[model samples]
Every structure is written in structure tokens, then in C-alpha cells.
Target chain A: MNVRRNLAGVLALCAVAMIFLPLLLTFYLSVFDETLIVFPPHGYTLRWYARIWPEFGAALRTSFFAALAAVAVSLLIGVPAGIGLARYRFRGRDAVATMLLAPLTVPGIAIGLGIFVLAVLIEEHTEWAISGSLALMVAAHVLITTPWVVRLCLASLANHDAAAEEAAASLGARPLAVLWRVTLPAMRSGIVAGGLFAFIVSFENLEMTLFLTAPGMTTLPIAVLQYLQYHIDPLVAAIAVAQVVFVGGALMLLDRHVKLAQVVA
Target chain B: MVEEEHPARLKSVSKRTAATGFLGPATLVVTVMLAAPLLLLLRFSLNRFDIKELMIETVTAENYLRFFTDPFYLGVLRTTVLVAVTSTVLCLLFGLPLAYRLARSQSRWKSLCMLAIVLPLFVGSTVRMVGWMILFAHGGMLDSAVRWVNGVGLEVMYTPFAVVAGIVSINLPYVVLTIQSAIETIDIRIEEAAQSLGAPPGRQFWLVVWPLALPGTAIAGILCFILAMNAYATPYLLGGPRFQMMAPLLYWEFSTNNNWPFASALALILMSTTLVLTACSNLLIPRRYRA
Candidate 1:
């Protein structure tokens, strides 16, 4: 017992230090007066934080709106699709499930590049360039995140009683009422958890955002990347700290209600 | 999805259908927005297309042939595999023990440990990679730490070491989380039974705990493999442009050179290799479980 306990305590401490110390160090780096990231700062200032306000503001706006739209679109499609998959004994269920989850397995490069060149071809055909447009970005995010909502909502639905749905239908409740009253209420936790997961996923997303972002349309991650390419500055550090606050808060909240392992896996 | 159901259970199936209206809007959205574009990319890969000429529409296998034949491209593939495998293996080595540790702890501490384990994931990979860049840089935190202990410095930043370190740090959360769940899945009673069979602590673990944990480890390894192989930004930033992966090469070919053909070809190659590796994993792993 003693050996096991100590091993666990030490490892937990290490994991904590692994994540937090660096975050704290980055936070410290942000406030330093010196532009360079070297330790033992000469003075402290909030100038870098101010710099992010104007420079990265538009990128933040784009990211927020993109993620918002993505969440909206995924919920619209995913919640229903989730119900059908989880509740119905349909043929080709396995194949459909695999198709839904396929994007997760494929390397993102294939998806992004494939989508990129495809968008261009559409532009030629339809005379509209959707590539790197906000709508395009939202569409990409939805493709990626919908499975999250579906998988989670399915899990929620699977746990509930089907008899209730049937009973409600027999009572002359419109199918919409049954879903709004019986189904959604039952899956609310999962829906919220799934939605939150989707939101966070959308929030911190970058890989897809990379190929998708044009010059005028950039997300926070892309902006940081572009800035870091030219110069390594504390403004990034300032932004990193701000983002961590939100992430840290969410992690604590999720860890409270549901096991992250269950939610994530 | 809107089937006729009871009013109390929330039926308005028909009206609900009418409410949402467009049944396959998202599907249409993905097909037009996602699928159509990718198909065009496949076409572009075959055609001789460039920034200046746009498309000559001449079909050619030259792009595919060149990528396969070129040593530069071949070397990038090799490095990508090496980085992916080494980093994934290392994460498993560290994560198995760490996850096992997390699983056996008290409930109060378990939640904290879980949060701590996953905290690294929440930070954007871009920011996380930057931290790693600084940490591994000469006279950086890692450098200073090594120097303080050994009276000499370690050169890691910008090397494969730094790249893999960044990879492991970024991916450590997933591995540990997987291993933790794997450990959780194995009922503790099985290990107890092994103890009653007069097994030593080592046997109790290797024979009982190890076997039970394999599936989770398999999953953990696969995830680490995917992240390592598909990883773009970390290597782009930390690995530098000098060290390349399959993903970034596809990126460079498409974005920098404006060679969508080569990029598409690279994308296909990447997909093929990934599918092959994944198929191999699926075959080998579950078979091992049965055996």
C-alpha cells in the first residue's frame, strides 16, 4: 500500500508540474519588460497584453464566429443523426458509423488539401471561391466536430428508455414534442457535454485552420503561427496565458461532472 | 430522425421534419463543401497545374512517379515514420507507468491527476510547441537543468530529439489517459486472484495486469502513431522546415510551390501509408489478443 501510494503521489505531482510549471513560466514571461524570453527579467509591464488587443483582435473574432457556426451546424445535423443511429435498428449501421468517424482516422492533410483543391474547382465551376472563406471554415469545422456530438448523444440516448418515446407517440404527441420533451431532456447532459467538447475542440483547433486560413481570414492559432514565423514575441505569451485561463476553467468543470476519460475516449 | 411518437415523449415528428426542413443540408454541405473540393484535388493531382498556367489538363503519373523516386521525398517519409514511432513508443513507456499510477490513487487525487494529465492538451499545440522550443533551446530551461546537474549542456533543440520531445509532450496526455482507462477496465479482483495463486508481485503484474492492459496500450499506441504521423505545426515550428513530415511536405508542395498536383499526390500517398499502417495495427493487435 505504501509503495503504491508513493508511486502514485510522485507521478501525479510530476504530471502536475509537467503541465503547470510551463504554463506559469509562460505567464511570467508575458509580463516581463524584456522582449526576449530569457529568465530573470529586469522589469514587468503589460505592453504585450495591450499589443494583442488590436493586432490579434480580428483573428479572435474570426475564430469565435467560426467555432460558433460550427457548433450550430453540427448540433443541427448531429443530434438527429445521433438519435437515428442510437435508437433505430437500421441496416448498414456499422458502415454509416464508420463513415461518420472516418475523418478522425484519416490524416488531416488529406482532408484539408482534398477540400482545398476541391473548393477551387468549385470556384471555377460555380464562379464562387468558397476556399478560405468563413463559410468554408465553418463547414470544415462542422465536418470534423459533428461526430463528437453524434457519439456522445448516442451514448446518452442508448442509456434511456425507448418505451417512453413510443408511449409519448401513442398519446398523440407530435414527433417533435417527443424529441423536444422526452429525447432532448434525457440526453441533455450528453448534449451539453458533447456541445462543450465540440466548442473546446473548435476553440483550440489549428491544423484544419492552417490550410483553410487566407491572408484576410485568420484564426488566433494561425495569427500566432504567422507572428512566430517573423518574430518570437511576448504578445504570444500574453495570448497563451489568456487562452489557458479558459482552458483551465473548462477542464476543472468537466473533471467535476464526468470523467474526462469517458468523455474524451 | 423525426419518426411518429407520443406527444408526451415530444412528438412533432412531421412538424419537426418541416421545422428543420432540409434533410441533408449538412450532408449536402459536406459533399459540396468538403467532398467536391477533395475530388477536384484528386483531379488536379493528375493534371499538370501550376500557379501561372493554372491547368493544362494533361493527365500524368509523373507527379506520383517523381515523389516515389526522389530520395528527398523518400527521406522525409522515413523521418516521419521514425519520429512517429519513436515518440509514440516513448510516450507508452512513460505513460503506462504514469497511467497505472493515476488509476490506483485515491479518488480525490485521481480527479486532480486526471486534470493535470489532460491540462497539456488544452493548451494549443502551437503554444505548447513554442514552450518546448524555448525549453529545449541552448541555455533554455531544459538546457539549464541538464547543465546544473551534469556541469555540461545537452544539445536538443532543433534536432530530432527536440521534435520528438515536443511530440511526446503534446501527446503525453492521450497516452496516459488511455493507459489509465485500460488499467481501470481491468477489474482489480483479477490481480487479487493471481496473488492467491502464490504469484510474486512481479508475476502478479506481468501475467495479470500486463495482459489486461494490452488493449488499452494498443489503442494508446495507435493514437500516438496518428498524432505523430499527422502532426504538422509542431514539426513546422519545432522540427523547423529542415526536418519534415508527410503532412508538411504535402503542405509545402501545395501552398508554397503552388503545385496542387504534387500536393494531392502527396496527400494520397500519405493516406495510403496511413491506411496500410492502421490496417496492419488492427490485424496484428486483436489477433495478439486472441492468441
Candidate 2:
């Protein structure tokens, strides 16, 4: 029994280490005073973090807007879709669910390539050029994020009591009023979860963004990649550390509102 | 009851129209934006690349023919599949024990471990790859640690080993989480019953728990395989210019070489292979146990 317990403990520790060691190392690397990332820094400094604005400021803003816009657009489409799927008994409902979730299975690179090809073809044929457009990037991100919003909202609405909405309606409440007061409130947690999922997925996404991003309008991850290709500096580490800190804060908020286990399941 | 009046108030045709109103926008966006582009990819792959014109014009099988005929491309496909398979199996081996532990334990530490698993998903794969690059680089932390123990340092960057390590690290959390969820569904009473019948714990797991969790574990394996196979940032960053994966190769064809037909062909191959494999696996698993 002791042996088995010890083995379990060891495995658990290894899993935790695998997940966190890289993040800790990245944070540690960011503070190194040396320009190049090396073990055992001579001294700690915040110069790299300070310098990130000049190096990656525009890309950061672009990524931020792109993620935020993607979240908003996905919610606009995905919330209604989720409600329809969860509440309505419609023809081809299964097909709609599959279509919404199908993007999850396709390779991101393939999606990016496909979108790029279509954009290029559109440019070839029409006056509408979507190659470097922020709208284009958000659209691509919506393709990636809307699935999460739909799935989570659907899950949230799965066990919802429609009787309450019915009772409200029978009490002379209009459909819009019931939706605004009761249904939306019931699915609030799911919408929040979905929005968080959508934001993170859009923000961290690289493969699809790789194809959509134009020269001056690059996202932060793309900028980091380009930077990495040229220089292996603590500045990139600083950017990474910044992202980790932001995500870590968001995660703490998520933990407070939702059970991580339930979310994953 | 108010039901008769409610049905009279909300006609079936109106209900259908309302459903369409709610669902139509998403369906249109997906059809126009996502599905249409894929169909276009299929068309692009069939056409021949025109260098001077800078786009595919004539229909030809040359791109795919070149892919299948060339040993170099074949070697790349092999390497990509091998790395994906190896890392997936590794994730399974490493993740299962941790997942089992998380599922069975009621300790506060379990919650912490679960948090650790989900946290990495929020962090960009690019940053994680960069972390791996630093750790495995010559004179990096891993080298220093190894040297302290063995009196010799190691250079791991730009190697398949580095790529596989990155893939495993990126995927392990997901594999563990899925398996843990699967294990959560198995009734604890069955394990107790097995124990009461004088079965050893390991025997009970193999006889009772393993069969129930097998489908989930298999699904986890498939997910890991697909992610590892389609990996872009990790392979591009850690694998360096020397190593070639299917994704980076496709990116190069489209981005650098300006060969849209070939790139489309490559994407079709990669995407189709993934779809077929997933389909086959789903078929292999019985409908009842499949997730």
C-alpha cells in the first residue's frame, strides 16, 4: 500500500513539474540581466520587461483587439446558436452541432491555409481584399473560438429548468422578457466560461493567425516567433512572462467562479 | 393548463422560424467562411501552379504525384507520424498514472495538480516552445543540471528528441485531464466489490477500472496523436531549420516557395489522414463506449 501510494505521489509530482517547470523557467529567464538567456543570471533586472513595449507594443494591441473582437463576435453568434440547440427541437440539429464542433478536429494550419487561399482568391477575383484585414483575423479566430462558446453554453443549458421560463411566460411575461430575465441568467456561468475559453483560444492561437496576419498588423505570438527567429533575447522572455502573468490572473478568476474539473469534463 | 393557449399563441411555423432566426447567422458564417474555404482548398490542390501568373490555373495531379513519388517527402511524412505516435504513447504512459491518482485521491493536493494541468492550456504554445528552447539549449539549465550530475553537458536543441519532448509537455496535461474525467465516471462501488471478493488492488483496476476507462484512454491517445501530428509552433521553434514536420513543410510551400497547389495538396493529405484515422478509431470503438 505504501509503495503504491509513493508511486502515485511521484507520478503526480512529475505531471505538475511537466506543466509548470517551463513557465517558471520562462519567468526566471525574463529577469536575467544578461541579454542572452543563460542559467544562473549574474543579476536580476526589469529592463527586458520595460523594453517590451517598444519591441512588441503594436503587435500586443493587435492581438488584444483581435481576441476581444473574436470573443464578442463569437458570443453574438454562438449564444443564440447555443440557445437554439439547447432549447429548440429543430430538424438537422445534430448536423448543426457537428458543424459547430467540426473546426475542433481540423488542423489549425489547414484552416489557416484554407482561409488564406480563399482570401487570396477573393483578391484575385474581386476588389474586396481581406488578406491583412483585422476583420479577417477576427473571423478566423471566430472559427476557432465559437465552438467552445457553443459547447460550453450547450453544456450549461443541458440541465437548465425550462419550467421556470414557461412559468414566467404563462404569467404574461413576453418571450424576450423571459429570455432577458430568466434564461440568460441561468446560462450566465456557461456564457462566462465560453467567453473565457474563446478569449484564450483566440489570443494564444498561432497557426491560423500566421496566415492571416499582414506585415504591419502582426499579433504578439507572431511577433514573438519573428523575434525568436532573429534573436534569442530576454525581451522575448519578458513578453512570455507577461502573458503567463495575465493568464494566471484570469485562471484565478476562473477558479473562483467555476470548478476546473467540471469545466474540463 | 396554460399549455393549450401557449401552443395557440406560439404556432409551430413561428417556432421553426424563431429557431432559424437564432441559428441562421452561425450556420451562414460557418458555411461561407469555414466550409467554403475548405472546398476551395480542394479545388486549389487539383490545379497546377503557374509561376509567372503566381496562382494555380490548370488542373493537374502533379503536386500530389510529386508528394507521393518523392522519397524526401515520404521521409518527412514518416518522421511526422513517428514523432506523433511516439509522443502520444509517451503521454499515455505518463498521464495515466497521474490521472488515476487524481481520480482516486481526495487530497487537497489533487486540486492543485488538476489546476497545474489546465493552466498550461491558457499559455501560448509559442511561449512554451521558447521555454523548451532555453532549457534544452547548449549551456542551458538542463545542460547545467546534467553536467552537475554526470560531469558532462548535453546539447539537445534542434534534435528530434527536443521536438518530441516539447510535444509531450504540450500534450500531457490534456491527456491526463481527459483520462481523469473518464475515470471519474466509473463507480467506486465496483472497486469496493472487487476488493471485498479478495482481489488485489492492481487486479481490481485491471479487471474493473481499466475496461471502463479504456475507451476514454483511447480517445485521449487519438487526441494527443492528432495534436502532436498537427503541431506547428513547437516543431517550428524547437525543431529548428534542420528538422521538417508536415505542418512546417506545408507552411514553407505556401509562404516561402509560393507554391499554392503543392501546399494545398499537402494540407489535403495531412487533413485527410487525420480525419480518416479518427474515423477508423471511432469505428473501432463500440458506439456505447465511444465519446
Candidate 3:
């Protein structure tokens, strides 16, 4: 029994190490003075972190605003759709849900290529140009992120009892008032979690953005990838460390309120 | 979720309208942006690629026929399938134990483990692949560490092994989470009952827990397989230019060669293969365990 328990402990530790050690290495490498990302650096320095902003500032701005817009749009579309799906049973309800979630099953590269084709066709025939517009990028991000919001909101709403809202309605509250005071409040945690999921997924996305981004306006991932293609440097590691820290912090904040395991499930 | 509907009230009209109103905006976005584009891809795939005009208005099956008849494309398909399957199997092998541990434990460590597993996802794949490059590069961390212990160096970067490793690492969290959910659904008493019958812990897991978790495992397997098949950055960065996966190949054809017809045909083939595999997994899993 002791031996088995020991084995389990070792296995757990190994799993944790495998997941985290690469990240720790990245963090260590970010501080190296060397330009080529070599190990056992001659000396440690903070130069890479200082240089990242000047190098990747625009990409950071683009990724931030695009992700923010995607989150807002996702919530606008997802919350209402989630509430409807949760509250009402209509004919072909399953089909509607499946269609909304279809993006998850499709490969990202295919979606990228398909959307590119659509943009090209529209550009060829129409006077209105939208091939690399921010609007198109946000729309594509919404396509990828909205499903997550819907799923999370649905999970949240399913756990919420509808009796409270009905009580509010019966107490002379208008339908809008009931939704504002009762329904939306109940779905608050779900919406927040869903919004966070949307933001992170959009920010990290590359496959969808690759085909949609213009030459000058690219997201952070694409910028980093392009940089890596030409040069292997600690500056990229600095950028990576920044991304990991931000995401890790947000996730930690999220875990304080909701069990992420339950959220994912 | 069904509230008691008051049949005599005028509120029913609003409720009836609300469903369509709520669904319309999202449906419009998805249809216009996603479904319509995929349909366009299908049309392009059926058309012929004209060298001078980019794409001619001719319908032909030559693209797909060429894909099947050419040994190069056939080999790429085979390599793609092999890498995906290998990485998925490796992910399952490594992830299942951790997933089971996480599911059964009530310790605070569970949350920490969850954070560790998921935090990597938010960090861009570009970053993680870069990290892998540093770790596996010649005279880099992995090489230096191995040399320190055994007086020998290791070389894995720019190889299929490195590509497979990267795929397994990225997909591990998803596989573990899915399987963890499956195992969590199993009643603890079922395993305890086996324990009471003189079965060892390992035996209990094999005989009782494994059978119950099989459905979730299968679903997780399907997800891992799909993710591995579609992976682009990892194969491109880690596998180097010599490596050819369908996604990167499709990207090359469209971006570099400007072969729209061929790229569309490849995209369709990848999409259809994933769809069929997913359908098969759902169809084959027993109804009770179907995800």
C-alpha cells in the first residue's frame, strides 16, 4: 500500500513538472543576455523586457483591442442566445445549438482559408472593401469565441433556478426589469467567466487571424511568429513571458471565484 | 428552464418573439461569416485552377483525383494520419493517470493542477513552440542536461519526434480535462465496492473505473486526434520546412503558390475527414456514455 501511494505521488509530481518546466525555462531564457536563446547565459539582463515594447507595441495594441471587441460582440450575441436556448424549447432547438457550436468541430486552418476565400470574392465583385478590415477580424474572432460564451452561459443558466425570475415578474416587475434585476444577475458569474474565456481565446488565436490580418495590422501571435521566422532571440521570450504572466494572473483571479474545472466541464 | 406560461396573458406574444429575436443576430453572423465561406470553399474545390486567370470557371474532379493518384500527396496524407494518431495515443497514455488523480483527489492541489494544465492554453502556441525550440535545439537546455548526466548530447529538434512531442504537450490538457470529467462522473462507491471484494487498487481501476470512463476516454481521444491533425504552428516550427502536414501544406498552396483550387480541395478533405471521425466516435460510443 505504501509503495503504491509512493508511485502515485511520483507520477503526479512528474505530470506537474512536465506541464510547468517548459514555462519556467521560457521565463529563465527571457532574462538571458544572449540574442540566440542559448542556455547557461554569460550573464543575466533585463534588456529583452525593456526592448519588447518598442518592438511589439503595435502588435500588442492590435491584439488587445481586437480581443476586447470580440469579447463585447460575443457577449452581445451569446447572452441572449444562451438565455433563449436555456429558457425556451422550440422545434429544431438541438439543430440551432449544433449550428452555433459547429465552429468548435471545424479545423481552424480550414476556417481561415474559407474566410479568406470569402473576403477575396467579396473584394473582387463588391465596391465595399473588407478583406483585412478590423471589422472582419473581430467578426472572425467572434465566430471562434461566441461558441465558448454560449456554452459557458448555458452551463451557468442551467444551474440557476428560474423561479426567482418568475417571482420577480409576479411582483409587478416588468419583463425587462426581471431580466435586468434577476436573470442577468444570476448569470453574472457565467458571463464574466465566458467573457474571460472569449478574451483569452481571441488574444491567443493565430490560425484564424493568419489569413485575416493585413500586412501592417497583425496580432501579437503573428508578430511573434514573424519575428521568430527571421531571428531567434530572447526578446521573443520576453514577449512570451509577458503573455504567460497575464493569462496566469487572470486565470488565478478566475479560480478565486469559480472552479475552472467545473467551468471547463 | 421552462417557466409556467400564463396562457391568458399577452406576455406569450413577447416570449414567442423573443426566441427568434435572440437567435437571429448570432445565426446571421455564423451563416454569413462561417457557413457561407465554407460553401464557397466547396465551390472552389469543384472548379479548376487556371494558371493565367487564377481559377477558371470549369468544374472538375481532377484536383482530388490528382491528390489520390500522386504518391507525394498520398504520402503526406499517410504521414499526417500517422503523426496525429501517434501524438494522440501518447497524450492519452500520459494524461490519463494525471486526470484520474485530479478527479479522485479532494486536495487543494487539484486547483493548482488545473491552473498548470490550462495556463499554457492562454499562452500563444507561437510562444510554446518557441520555448520548445530552445529546449530541443543543439547544445540547448535538453542537450546540455543530458550531456551533464550521461556524457552525451541529444538532438531532437527539427524532427518528427519533436513535432510529435509538441503536439502531445499542447493537447494533453484537453485530453486530461475531458477524461477527468468522465472519471468524476463515476460513483466512488463503485470502486469501493470492488475494493471490498478483495480487489487491489490497480485491479479496481482496471475492472471498474476504466470501463465506466471508457466513453469519456473515447471522446477525449477523438478531440486529441482532431487537434493533432489540424495543428499548424507546432509542425511548421518544430518539424521544420521539410515536414509536411495538411494544414501547413494548405497554407503554402494558398499563400505561396496561389493554388486556390488545390488548397480548397485539401481544406475540404481535412474538414470532411475530421467530421467523419467525430461522427464515428459519437455513433460508436454506447448511448449511456456518449458525450
Candidate 4:
């Protein structure tokens, strides 16, 4: 019994280490002074950190704005969809819910290709140039992110008592008023969590964005990938560390407001 | 009840209208943005490829036939399946015990541990692949460590091994979290009851926890399998150019070769493979535990 328990403990520790060691190594590698990474560097410096913005600043900005736009659009459309799914049973309700969540199940690369092809076909058939546009990228992001928003919002409302909304309605309040005053407030944490997830998903996305990006226009992950193809340096490591810190910090901060584990579960 | 009938009927009508109003924008967006694209992709996959015109409007299964008949593409598919299956099995092996421990742990730092597992997930696979590259690269950490012991450096980077390891790392957390939640739902008293009945630890788990946890394990496995099957960056980065996987191959066909028909066919094949496997696994699960 003791042996088994010890084994389990050891395995658990190893699992944690496996997850973390790479991240720590990325941070460690970023500090190496040498251009060509080798095992124990002679010295450490923060030069790579200083080089990140100059190297990939444009891509970073593009990713950030695209993620933000995706979040905004996802929330605008997804929250109401969640409310609709949770509050009412209408014809084709299950179908609508399934359609909304279908993106989560499909492979992202396939979706990217599909959207890219769609953009091409649309451009060929029309005067509007939809291919390689930021709007197109954001639209794809919205397609993916809306599902998560809808999911989290549904989760948040799963245990919520509808009596409050009903009470407001019974007291002569309009449906819109009740939704604004009561239902929306109830979904606040879900909204915030969904937006945060949407941002991360969009910002970190590579598969879908790879197909959508133009020659000069790219997102941060694509920028990192392209750079890695030509260069193997600590500067990329520094950028990676920065991304980890940004995402990790956001997760921790948001976890305090919304139990992200519960939300995900 | 009779007194409230009119109000109830009015409320039902209003509720239906409200539901439509609320769901309309999202439904419209998904149909237009996602559904239409996918449908168009399906159409494109049937059409003949034309280098000059991009796509010739015709219905043909030439692309699918080409993928299946070509042994080179078949080999790529086989390698992709091998990588995905290996990584998923590794994830299950590593994830189950850790998830069991995490689920049962009463430590104050449990949430922190959960955070540690999940934090890696939020970081992009590209960043994680960079980390793996540093570790597996010639003269990198693993090589340095081995050399320190044996005076001969190792080179595992850009290999199938590195690709599998990178994918396993990416998928482990997801499996762990899924199984942990499942394990959390199993009542502790059941295990206690088994213990009091003098069943050994292994038997207790097999008899009590395993059956209950089977559904979650199945789910986690399916998720990991799908993720691995569709993996792009890990294979693209760690597997290198010599090693080809479905997602990357599809991208190469579309982007480099500009074979939209072929790429679309590849995409459909990959998606269908995952869907079929997922359905098969779902059928494997006992009906009572399916919810």
C-alpha cells in the first residue's frame, strides 16, 4: 500500500514537473547571453527581452486587436444565445444549441481552410475583397470564440434561480428591463470569463490564422513560427516568456473573480 | 389555474418571441460564417483542381482516390495515426494517476496545482514547441545532461519522438482535468466501503472507481485523440519537414501547392476520421453511463 501510494505521489510530481519544466526552461533560455543556445551559458543578460518589441511588435499588435475584437463580438452575440438556450424551449432549440457549439468539436485547421476557401470564392464572385483582411480573421475568431462564451454563460446560468427574473416580470417590469437588471448581472462572471478565454484563444491561435494571414500581415504566433523557421535565438524565447507571463497573469487574476476551473468543468 | 390561463398563454407567446430574438444574431452569424464556409469547402473538395483557375467546377472523387491510392499519402496517414495514438495512450497513463491524486488530495495548494496544469494550456503550442526545441536540440538541455554523464551528446530534435513528447505535454493537462472532475464525482464512501470489506487498493479501484470513472476516461481519451490527430504546430515544429502529419500536410497542399481540391479533401478525411473514431468509442461505452 505504501509503495503504491509513493508511486502515485512520484508520478503526480513528475506530471507537474513535465508541465512546468518547459515553461521554466523557456524563461531560462531567454536569459542566455549567447546567440546560439548551448548548455550552460557563460553569462546571462536581459538583451532578448529588450529585442522582442522591435522584432515582432506589429504582429503582436495585430493579434491583440484581433483578439479584443473577437471577444467583443463573441460577447455581443453569444450571451443572448446562451440566455435563449437556458431560458426558453423553442422549436429547433437543440439544433440551434448544437450549431452554436459545433465549432468546438470540428478541427480548427479544417475550419481555417474552409473559411479561407470561402473568402476566396467570395472575392472571386464579388467586388468586396474579403481574403486576408483583419475583418475576416476576426470573423473566424468570433466563430470559434462564440461557442466558448455561450458555454460559459450556460454554465453560469445552470444553477441560477429564474425566480428573480420572474419576480421582476411579475412586478410589471418588461422583459428587456428584467434582462438588463437581473439576467445580465447574473451572467456577468460568465461574460468576463468568456471574454478572457476568447482573447486567449484568438491571441494564441495558429492553425486557423495561418491560412487567413496575408504576406505582410500576421499574428504573434505566426510571427514566432516564421521567425523560428529562420532563426534559433534567445529572442524568441524571451517573446515566449512574455506571452506566458501575460496569459498566466490574466488567468490568475480572472480566477479570483470567476472560478475558472468550475467554469471550464 | 383557470384565472392564470390568459396570462400564462401570453407569457408563453412572449417567451417564444424572446427566444427567437435572442438567438437570431448568433444563429445567423454561425450559419453565414461557419456553416456556409464548410459547405463551400465540401463543394470544393468535389471539384477538380486547376492550377490556372484554382478550381474547376466539377463533381469528382479524384482527390479522395489519389489520397487513398498513393502509398506515400497512406504512409503519412499511418504516421499521423501512430503519433496520435501513442500520445493519447501516454496522456491517459500519465493523466489518470495524477488526476486521481489531485481529485483525492486535501492539500491547501490543490487549486494552485490545478492552476499549474491549466496555465500551460493557455500558452500557445508554438511557445511550448519552442521550449521543447531547446530541450531536444543538439547541445541543448537533454543533450548536455546525457553528455555530462556519458560524454556523448544526444540529438532527438526534429524527430517523431520529440513530436510525440511535445504533443503529450500539450494534451496531458486536458486529460488530467477531465478525469479529475470525473473522479471528484465518485463518492469517497464507496472506496471506504470497499476498504472495510478488505479489498486491496488495486481491487478497490478496479471494482469501484474504474467503472464509475470509465465514462470520463473515455471522454478524455476521445478529446486527446482528436486533438492529437488534428495537431499542427507540434508536428510542424518538432516533427520537422521530413515528418508529415495530416493538418500540416493539408496546409502544405493548400498553401504551397495551391491544390485547394486536394487540401479540402484532406481536411474532410481528417475530420471524418476523428468523428468516426469518436463515435466508435462512444458506442463502446455502456449506455447507462453515456449522459
TM-score of chain B of 4: 0.90
The stretch of ten residues in a row with the least summed lDDT in candidate 4 chain B is B114-123
TM-score of chain A of 4: 0.92
Model 2 agreement with the true structure over B179-270: per-residue lDDT tens digits:
99789878889999999999887788778898899888997888798888788888888888879999999999998989988999999899
Best by TM-score: 4
lDDT of 2 by residue, A1-265 (tens): 6687677577767766776777788888888888776777789999888888998899999989999999999999999999999989977999988898888788888989999888887898999987889989999999989988997788788869789989999999988999899988898877887887798789888877889998899998888888888888778878878876777777767777776655655
* Every candidate's lDDT: 0.74, 0.84, 0.84, 0.86
Clashing pairs in 2: none
lDDT of 3 by residue, A128-226 (tens): 789999988998999989988887788789878999988998899998998899989888877886887798779988877889999889999889888
Task: Supply the DockQ value of model 4.
Answer: 0.57
- Better TM-score candidate (1, 2): 2
Q: Scoring model 2 with DockQ, what do you get?
A: 0.53
Q: Ten consecutive residues with minimal summed lDDT in candidate 2 chain B?
A: B108-117
Off by over 4 Å in 1: A1-21, A158-178, A250-265, B1-34, B49-54, B100-106, B109-113, B145-152, B178-217, B288-291
True C-alpha contacts between chains kept, each model in order: 0.35, 0.51, 0.58, 0.60
- For model 2 the interface RMSD, in Å, equals 2.5
lDDT of 1 by residue, A29-106 (tens): 788787666655678999988888798899988988888888988888877777777666445557666666566666
For model 3, the stretches where C-alpha displacement exceeds 4 angstroms are A1-14, A170-172, A253-265, B1-13, B109-112, B148-152, B179-219
lDDT of 2 at B11: 85
Instruction: Indicate whether candidate 1 or candidate 2 has the larger lDDT.
Output: 2
* lDDT for each residue of candidate 1 in B192-251, tens digit (9 for 90 to 100): 898898887767877888877887888788878887888887788877768888888887
